[model samples]
Target: MSKWTERMTDLIKSVGGFAKANKPVAEAFHTLETATRADGILDAKTHELIALAVAVTTRCDGCITAHAAAAKKAGASKAEISAALGTAIALNAGAAYVYSARALEAFEEL
Candidate 1:
């Protein structure tokens, strides 16, 4: 198995233990997650890609691994997943770039 695959396996086992110990809370979370992830305007594949992008933006390794696996399972090609990651990178960089303008304005005011 790939490193990510192993990591995901371990993470799932750990989370499963915690969920089992906290069944009520876990079930509530599961219900919420399931409902939110259910198809609406977006298809499952597209949603998985979006989840991957959000995971990247949030710097959550577990989320990245989980969503990458899900995205692949949902038929997202490597190219499509890569594109989603690229969008995350660009948005993060763009946010910093835009904030730099504000930083400069603040310095000028000082």
Candidate 2:
């Protein structure tokens, strides 16, 4: 198998084990998954794409890699992936700037 496939398999195994060991965690995962499915606001592919964007913005390497792979499998093209990443970066930058400005105000008041 390819390296990506191997890594994904390992990740799945790890998460599965964790879920099996922790009832609360397992329940939470199930609940979230069910809610996402029931919401139907976005298709699976779109949801995966959104996940990829959020992972990129949050700088979660593992999540980014996994979601990118999932997005590809869900029929997202390279161009789409790139666009999503760009959007994520823009949003992250804006959010950081806003937070930093607020932090500066707080610091000045101290």
Candidate 3:
């Protein structure tokens, strides 16, 4: 189910190989990820937590495992991770509720 964190180094090297094949775009994406993940206003743990939340919403198992590992390494507790996940869940639920209303209106129009 989850192999990303289990073999993160391999996955990263594989990405490098893929980027080499894809040329500029993939390489640029890697660079962008590096820049985005760098410690800025928020610490690494906070960033990783946010990334985990995004991973859940996107249904990316690899991302979930990877960011979670990173978050743990960055000193985030299980409770903090749970809280971040809760926010993602709440946001997704809220989005569904709002979109359901839109869908209903569209159905009425049709």
Candidate 4:
């Protein structure tokens, strides 16, 4: 299997094990997912694209794999996914810039 395919398979199995170990939390998360999907202005592709961006921002391997698959399933093109990832990269850099200023201020205060 390909690297991402294997990772996704492992993620699925791990999630199942987590659900078995903690049904209530898993159920709650499922409920949240269901609620999010129940009704929303954004189309599936848009939602999945946003999810992919967030996954990149958060540096979550599981989320990246899952959302990449979901985004593809939702008909997000590679260009669209790349654009979303670009936004994530920009946001991370912006966040670092803001935090660096804050760190400098803290150092000055010290």
Which candidate ranks first by TM-score, i.e. highest? 4
**Lowest-sum lDDT 10-residue window in model 1:** 33-42
What's model 1's lDDT at 8?
98
TM-score of 3: 0.83
**Each candidate's lDDT (Cα)?**
0.92, 0.85, 0.87, 0.96
lDDT of 4: 0.96
Check candidate 4 and list the clashing pairs: none
Tell me the tens digit of each residue's lDDT in model 3 across 37-64: 5758778988999999999999987687
Which rank order by lDDT, best down to worst? 4, 1, 3, 2
- Global local distance difference test of model 2: 0.85
Model 4, which residues run further than 4 Å from truth?
A: none
Model 1, residue 68: displacement in angstroms?
0.7
Model 4: per-residue Cα lDDT over 1-110, one tens digit each: 89999999999999999999999999999999778778877889999999999999999999999999999999999999999999999999999999999999999999
Give me the overall lDDT of model 3.
0.87
Worst 10 residues of 2 by lDDT: 56-65
lDDT of 1: 0.92
